[model samples]
Target: MKTLLSLSIGALLAGSSLLSTSALAATHAPYTHTQFSITESVQPADILVVLVPENAGELRLAGWDRASRNHINRAIEVAGFDGKAGAQLEIVAPVGLSYGRLLLLGTGNPADLTRAKAETMGASLSTWVNGTKAESIHVNSQLIANAADNHRISAALAHGVELRNYRFDRYKSQPEARPSQRYSWQVALATDARSKFEQKQALAQGVFTARELTNLPGSDGYPEAFANYAKTVLEPLGVEVTILGPEEVKALGMGALYGVSQGSHMKAHLLVARWRGHDDAQPIALVGKGNSFDTGGYNLKTQAASILRMHTDKAGGAAVVGAVKALAGQKAPVHVVGVVPLSINMISGDAYLPGDVVTAGDGTTIEVGNTDAEGRLILADGIWYAREHLNARVIADIATLTGAKVGALGSAYSAIFTQDAAIEQSLRQAGELVQERVWPMPLDGYDGIVRSRIADKINTGSPGAQAGAIFLQHFAADTPWVHIDMAGEAFVSSASGIHPEGSTGHGVRLLTEWAKLYQAKQD
Candidate 1:
């Protein structure tokens, strides 16, 4: 377990409302790292892994001696292990090898081994290795026929291993201890994949940070704490962070956001974090809805299951900061701005009630049909601020905003709403590559869903998910924008794939990859 180290230091900037600092330090729980060495030779280890492709005729064992190959062949013949993807075979005390164990990991087809598939294979490998007590392992990466493809596949596998190792045990009374001894990980490849692997490591770091923040209980996960985290984690990496407390938020005329904050004794805040890897390039904005803990305001949630995990509502904000951390950590040449509006929608005497209308930062009026629909209210002002004040070239707001989205897409995909076909296509491609996939939802006919008789727009509408998208789209105006309703994708009910049974950290990779692609196109 790790905690924030406190210091009696404070500063004020940007007016009476902006509080910014770089001296704060918040340490996260220590993450595990396997001591990996890239090499051309397969060193002797307790466990030796041979890569077996489905096309056995095309398989090429780079460093295996004749004797070792004969023994492996005999084992393969005996076990009837044709190299199908996800198939595994193990032999203990092999005939010609002194190793304690020999394992064969299957690659479906060398030609079909994409980065996504490689990551899946790596995840499976992590699980298999964790079940064993081996102290070291050697992996052979010579199964693929193409050298460039081999390097990329190997790097993606290493990334998968790192991602699967993430565990959130901060509050566990006796957290399960991982294997104490430092495990030695050696990989034999024709070309060095260390640089590629390190880039993936940077992404994993961002994902880990996003997961940790989302897993924290509402008691510890608050607006101030998140701001402190950004200052501590991102500022050192050269990102500029600014924290706007309740006063600042109200002073900026973000009435819709301020209305939602009145419900909680704990005030709301707006956090602005910017990472500028290029001086003159226009920055893209990543706006995340930071509802630290939502009690549905006056329209309280009746079921325990619905309210038990509301702390994860802040997952979107965590991912935005995480993506920025990743881009800045690698010093990627892109300018990105992150706008997160942090608030807790708890019931109180002063809480904004249903049917109330409030003006947003951009002077648009919003009627609160259902106080439970608070995410879009805060995001409304967040998007407006990003576009009007920050001068962002494109705006993408991600949130676990609607339950209707879950019914529409389920746990497999997130729902994205955008008018621009290019933005939609780019986001989908990025999501597919990173495995945080997005499917487009209709935004045209849904405009009527948010049309309010009493205000500029209604926060809640008939088709819940599309209504939320259209509500935020009003704030985005004519800018290239996308509204990602990740209600189904942010947190998982069960562990699967590379994600554990908790916050998936879904948007961090998607946003980071999209930003990379967007910047490349700009050049």
Candidate 2:
């Protein structure tokens, strides 16, 4: 085993800022600044959104006054919109109505209106009202029975709107204005909803940060730049940011991570961020693969999609940073550490070939099966570092590891591999809660597949996703761990609901939810 050389954040930041402060300011600022508030009475707005449940017998709009409800009921009857979840109806308010427009948002079966569904409803509503050019809007939370339910549902709704309003136009020299940018929100409820929504807002901002990082071009979003950005954003939020350069990584014997960066001039970076919410508790480690751009190394990606969209290869690491940001911003009472192995996989004379054998930080040798299978190799070192050096009791490593995962689960869900049933269940529940749903993939019966004749294991094997998981499992050793393959979930080809056409920032909310749950258990 190699000696772990601890370094201060100041030392790391001095040499690693590839972008200037002005450049960072232009590129890294928050994209949306929509204001939100909760009030006792419905405020005047261009539009009024009433949450409506399906009629068991009569049309129901519980919160609105009798005159407004009667007008909306007539509009609903004319539109023939059944009060199914996600069903929406908008009508021009008549002469007597106070608002310019009225929107009836369905809750489906009242019992079926979960937090997840409520978020989706908010996304759908935001998307629908985009072109309507509404400057201010009020969402009636009156139908929700009690203050607690109203707070939770309103927070969820506003979170969805915040997420849906995300726009990545940094690169656009003359971007068109989005109406969501100008709107202010009022969610009508009895009790204060800002605190709950503030927590969710932190998460939304985290997701936005992740999306911006993922969407940045490889030319601008290199390893050093990522480290610099993390230090700038996370450190202020009380995260301890430590960055290790190539020589330092080599000294630490992170050969598997270092090997991938051999071809690139940018070198490699191991970014460790600690959010110490507790004094002495063992932290949950989030290890992510941070390949800023992937060119399949010496193997070379001949396909256009693989080469063109390779900038998003670092999304897993971006998500880890985002989750940390969210946890720190919300002041969650949980100790968590994010370990990201940053590199750019390019084809060059110095590139590590497919047949090369690299030693991991734990001294396990990994025979590179394919240069394109570089994510697992880097994560191997990251997971080991987290488990051994950071004293993380539970390790969850996420990456855009395989195309086979997309083939298996499509873009709808992330693929999770874990031996622990509890970890799997918790991750699934968290993912579901945040709309970043995960489907469990088998981790067993693949021990032989990753077995190599010379090394401890091969980087990849026959069943791509399973074999990759097995190889990473060796690094985690006996520690409880879960591997999330988010290849298909990270980038979207088209805009849908809350997601735009670029990076989805998928894992931020899921990881935050899981970490919160894990913290509760620890407490």
| Best-matching candidate per lDDT | 2
- Give the per-residue lDDT digits (tens) of candidate 2, residues 228-277: 87887788789999999999999999999999999988899999999998
**Model 2 bad stretches (over 4 Å):** 1-28, 56-70, 109-111, 181-191
lDDT of each: 0.78, 0.80
**What TM-score does each of the candidates earn?**
0.91, 0.91
lDDT of 2: 0.80
How well does model 1 score by local distance difference test?
0.78
Question: How many pairs of residues collide in model 1?
Answer: 0
Tens digit per residue, CA lDDT, model 1, 45-98: 888777777757533364557777777788788888888876788988766676
